[model samples]
Target: MNTKMFCYQCEQTVGCTGCTGNAGVCGKKADTARLQDELTGALIGLARAVDGAETISKRTSQVIMEGLFTTVTNVSFDDAAIETMIQKVRAEKERLVPDCSKCQSSCGKTDEYDMQQLWDANEDVRSLKSLILFGIRGMAAYAYHANVLNYEDAEVNRFFCEALFKIGYEESVETLLPVVLKVGEINLKCMALLDKANTETYGTPEPTAVTLTVEKGPFIVVTGHDLKDLQLLLEQTEGKGINIYTHGEMLPAHAYPFLKKFSHLKGNFGTAWQNQQKEFDHLPAPILYTTNCLMPPKSSYADRVFTTEVVAFPGAVHIDEKKDFTPVIEKALELGGYKEDQILTGINGGTKVTTGFGHAAILSHAGTVVEAVKAGAIRHFFLVAGCDGAKPGRNYYTEFVKQTPSDSIILTLACGKFRFNDLDLGEIGGLPRLMDMGQCNDAYGAIQVAVALADAFGCSVNELPLSFVLSWYEQKAVCILLTLLHLGIKNIRLGPSLPAFLSPNILNFLVKNYGIAPITTPEEDIKTLLNHNK
Candidate 1:
């Protein structure tokens, strides 16, 4: 088949393999996907060239991060933005290796790989490289968020180049497996750096319950992965008769003391990342995207979309580096919100959801959790965490949570929790059955809890009766998944579908080596899991 530009890197893509003929399930045109692939290819080339350079500048790192991140699912739905990123990558390459233009012979080392070649490579080779590429793309989003807060880790930045360089090289499962785990190890540090930046800058998150209702009058909805941008928005819009509500991963921002201190910083407004198109369609408030998970806007709310940091949408107002959010605030006031307090509920009709069960909160109750487990009150632990989307099969997560044995503990994080977060799962041993461990980046906290439990039990993490049933949608999930793989944690069940970018050989390798399985029916999977534990 002569593939066109469309791709199915996400869980929900047209026809499962990829959207080559026309538009994607997310409504991205074929041409846009092609441009994004071009940008990614250029980024891979740049990283390969800069891998061991003596003097790679901060600018090189920043562009590499931005270029990879922009290709993440639903981040840049605009063709023009991808084109701009391609140009930026090209310019960076020109600056780094200016002699490329004058050289008589071409050195394939610094040249961009046609993405089609990757797509057509041996299935196993393509899958391994895809793992490195996609994993870093997701990690870059987190790195970008942390970078904006002025927190950067040298190792994290360097591993990004290492990972990218590997993507361009020919390698096998033996060579790639170590690099795969390396992605996870590096992602763990990257996540910790972000955790430190977030907790230190904003106080350690305390347990918080937020409502879904929007109070009367003007309000602004802030979405994406960046907290600093939301904090800045909250600051600039404070006391201006404007309310700030969270959307997507920003839902956890409500639990941060520094953010919650703002009186007008209101509650969350929607479900997971995938519902934005419908939810924001007629929304009166302006939405400011500080990071990823941005969908192309509907014409009705297009003018009201505002972006800051690297989250640019075509034609929407951008706040730029200065972070002056006057335009976003103005849009909110202009929209003027509801005439009365609008009462809304989650998928379960619950008016509120509680969050902020980061490592601090979970560890504070560690003694209790340990006692409960020792007493046989809590039998097993399930970490059902990752990004959520609109795919029909994603109901598997909600079903999986519901099907967990009563003696088990469920620790969830990220936008995926929205699927069943509103349900009153009640408590086990004085701890809520479902603990929202902050955003996707806060997987660091979940890992901390696992390690602490392992230490208490005097065993390795995999020996602590812990199971990771993960759902992935974008790049951040990729990084976290890599982290889990790096930890040598086996018997993971991933769903609702495998990445279309992964070749059959790569999938088989993961299955044979890591015991990674696709999600089956909840009953079947639960039975299989219980048998394994037994």
Candidate 2:
């Protein structure tokens, strides 16, 4: 029960359980892990203080969401940054309950809960509460992104505090069960909020073709899922004799009209976040990460990594609220990029990829899509998307997409699309069969497509010939999965592996009630999914 660092929140937890040593499997140091725990504890106290009648401040919302998200898997590796977030949480708590500190009588009513107690609790209770805690951590990232664009939902904003309150106060399994599922319910709204913010600010993403070439010139490669950060960086770097390339989750930025208006905004550079160490090694450009999916930098690229917002790594230059891009710009100029245009390809070796199939874009062509299905030109639909990771088993997604029937369409989002997005999948009704729906939070868009399809056919979502084959790496995927289950979508095929935190009882319940199963080979699972239609 005495563990220095215990983290089992993601698909890559060491030994399929917690990482209880120097670092987690994802390269988080022991000290960083402890700071994350401290951050969580402080966030809980902040949430507890704001639980009742007080109208939570906008800054309080930002701090709650950003602090929780900062602790997600690979998002923040800087202990100093994490401590700063902890201080923000404490300040917010004091702002909410100013009298608690100065009162003479002893009272422990609003004190921060020690994380060790939760870690040492009964396994089932811990598992349920963990779901609530981890699920919201993922939701917070989406909320933060939306908040940056001046989009805020009162219900979605309050849920963070409520969920954190439950995580800190509710101990019994029965009381926590509903709260655990509420995280899923709230996350859907949070994702929708982000979708509105992004689309309104950047325009609905259209099906635009993006190249994998790094144009000749000094350039900056931007990664992560924050479009607002990308937008500001694009504005700052315009007309500076530099090219801008998207990488990882930022690939979809190229499809947004508002961003693509910048002529210097070039093409995408590398693949998913997991490949950064190899992809960025000795690169002639600086990388500005706007959010999560940052690996611990290799010394080769350590000096070139620039982080903004909640994404911080030790020794990397951080851009604060000032949104200054001077350091990143100077680094790019010093590196002086390739002498000539360099072509890059995805893992499957295609020179170009296509994205921007947001819900509005797809539904705008809904009549044509429905007719194609009626004419038997399209046989089925598959959502083969989620977060990507370093595990070799992730190749399953690539193979699954590759082996899908030519008449079927693959709707993908998040970094997982890097596995198969570069491949040409042909088209039906002017829409490529393989459609990229932006980042993970764009799961909101995917859900919209599903609901629209169901309404068009006058049947339930599960009644439609659609299958979900998901690959999860982090907590964002957890919230999305819970949202799917909340919608009563059944028989999902999840892999590279199930999460390590789910207790035997919780896992069994998911299987029995939701018909969720771990994925087998692409060949067998695809056949099973296709057969279900008959």
Candidate 3:
């Protein structure tokens, strides 16, 4: 049967095919996903119209990024929020192509393309467009993160339009391949901008160990991707007798010296982003989401879900652009956390996991790492990181990390590390076996480490003995994957599920050229990887 709705942009789609019925596995209604597609299509049209229009304004670029980011998994589950974004996109298009509206006969030039067309097109065409669309969606997340700090890169912003414009046009692999790589190239710039903004503003992250224990008294649990919101919360809740515990992506915030300096700022609360529904339920403190990966809050903690900076859930208290977190603070005091200290362990029953092994921290210890490698202490480096989700099969990550040879080093970032971050993997040459490289947006750190290692060995990054086993749940990961591909990095094993968006032809192309494969059982996949290395 022909598909009714085309919504397969995440790891958890209905039936593991695509969500074609009334709602997606993520609970995104058909209407909302369609609007998201429309918004995306309009952005593509705008990009096409403004192809070389002198210069693209920051406002235009911000709207494009925000529009794309809103469609990411678990971000805006509300259809009304998407409607508002669609309107915003239309308004932006109107501003860009005002003359098109006055044409006596309708000019298809500025009109949005129905997403179903791309979904139902020839496999090759659909695959190429999916790359363009998904690639931009990922880039938008990095761009959005960078934008929050008032740092912007012109090249990155310009490429957003360029990539989107290509999605709406007819193009081949030979012609579109460059645009695909350009997405990765621009995403690298975007990540660097965010890295600079975060390090400069929050101070370079150090090798810090964060405890899972929640201190007694009033505390606030903050999640999502925005460090700015977490910093604002830290500032406002200071000296108020309320403690702040980082949760989910915010765990990395504790690694920053500027953020960690606050006495009230406590340690991390949960493992990864997917466990929020279970973890946040009946929690004594208010949970604040500054960005995406917000699960539909359960009634038990629904009232306690506070949002800020574009993260919105109906009926949740939203901190506005002014960034006043008074509501969240009030909720924290009202909730009045545990009377005594509560010890919380990770998935592995460990009480603490260390983070802050960002590019700077790792590169500073490069000499030690290289020496360890040369001395036969570190045999392989496995980058086992990506988005974490509720999928049952995602345990592959935990098992994969568990089964890696003792001689290997594990580098992880993003929410995915929650799966095995707590396991006591022991240390190699004074460095922890599992190094947390900050948040998902901090994929930049992993890239930085890979490049530094390659430089030390005087080899190309692909020549280094490193393997990336990624598990993606959202669009931010999409951009990072593309960046790796753009750098010509090969033999990546991606799972728990392939994105529903990629057509068979595109999948074949990636497999043939990039050696990308969906993960199998941990035991089997490990054997395959070890053999490949041999």
Candidate 4:
């Protein structure tokens, strides 16, 4: 147990369990991991101190959300950046508990939590707390995006402190269980907040085809999921002879009317975050990461990497809150882009992909979709969504989406769509069968579509001919999945593997109660889901 690093918070942990070595399977160093733990512990302390607020201020909530989300897997790797976050949380804690240290009797009201204690706790308890902790981390991303747009939900913000306090203070598995599910409940609110923030700020997304080709010339590749940053960059880069290409979760930006207005804002650069190391290695463009799913940069591409907001690597250029992307612009121009226009296809080898199918767009065509169902043109709907990763078995998503019957429509979100997004799925009733439903936070939109369809069909969502085949790699996906479970949605297929954080008993409980199962072959799953639909 005296390991240099102890982390199993992600799907890519060493030995398919915990990483107890010098480096994590995701390329996080022990030093960075320790700092992340400290950041998390400090955030938990802030949460503990600020507990029971009559009304949680947006500023306190912002700090809590950023601190929690910053510690999510593969988010931040710089010890310095994490230390800064630790300081922010500590300052907030001090602001809340000015007199706690001067009290006559000692009260450990806001003591910083030791993450190792949670890691070392009993298996079931650890599993529940992990769900609560990780779920909020995911929820925080949505909350962060919302806050960036001046949209804040007090309830969703309050739940963060409540959940973090539970992680630091509550000991019972029974006590942690409901809070674990409440993470799902509150995340639904968080996602809804983000959905409103985005649709209101950027306008409702419509289906838009995004080119995979990176145009010849100086261009900066923006990754992660911050739309505001992308918009600001687009504004700054406009007519600068510098093309801006979206990458990772930012691919959905191409569908936003406001962003797409920038003609020089070019296409997407890479598939998912996991491929950045390989994809950016030979790239002549600088990559600006605005959020998570950032891999530790390889030496070859390290210099081309720029991080902003909560994302960081030790040596990469850090864009401050001013949103001035000049460093990334300068880096991209220095790289001089390509000798000729570079055509980049997705993993499927298709030249283009479509996105922008948020809730409003989907519901606008709701009547047609419903009529198609009645006409038997669309027999089923598969919500094949969640984060994409580098694991071998992730091809299951591609195969699953590909193997879905022609009569079935695929509703997708997040970066996982890169697997088959390039593949032309054709159309059913004048609607593209493969509909991209914005970013991971837009899982709220997917939920809305599901609910609307159920309401139109006069049946429970579980009774509808819909299936959820999700692939999770990090905390955001965890919260989205929890939101699903919170809605009492059943018969979900999660893969390429279940989380290591879920103990045998806790996993068993999920299976028995929810009918959630790990994905098998695409053929087998398709058949099972089709039969279940019958």
Number of clashing pairs per prediction, in order: 3, 0, 0, 0
lDDT string for model 3 (1-534, tens) is: 233567777878876677888777776667767767777777777777678766789989888889888877777766667778878877787887786756687455676766767887777777777777887887787788878889998888888887777777765677777787777888888889999999999999998888899988899988887888888888898889999898888888888988988988889998787788898889999998888878778999999998876566778877778988888888888989998999999998999988999999999999999999889898889999998888789889999999999888999999899989889888898888889998988998899899889989998877777888999987778888989998889999999888776777778888999999999888887777766655
| Superposed Cα deviation of residue 430, candidate 3 (Å) | 1.2
Regions of candidate 1 where Cα sits further than 4 Å from its true position: 1-3, 171-173
TM-score of each: 0.96, 0.97, 0.95, 0.97
Global lDDT scores for all candidate models = 0.85, 0.89, 0.83, 0.88
User: In candidate 2, which residue ranges exceed 4 Å CA deviation?
Assistant: 1-3, 99-108
Q: Which portions of model 3 miss their true places by more than 4 Å?
A: 1-4, 99-104, 531-534
Candidate 2: tens digits of C-alpha lDDT, residues 429-522: 7778999988899999999999999999999899888999999999999999989988889999999988888899989988999999999999
How many residue pairs clash in model 4?
0
Lowest lDDT block of 10, candidate 1: 1-10
> Candidate order by lDDT, highest to lowest?
2, 4, 1, 3
**lDDT of candidate model 1 versus the reference:** 0.85
Query: Against the true structure, candidate 3 has what lDDT?
Result: 0.83
RMSD of 2: 1.6
Question: Higher lDDT: candidate 2 or 4?
Answer: 2
**Residues 288-347 of candidate 1: C-alpha lDDT, one tens digit per residue:** 887888888889888888877666677887787888988888888888998999999998
lDDT of 2: 0.89
lDDT of 1 at 495: 84
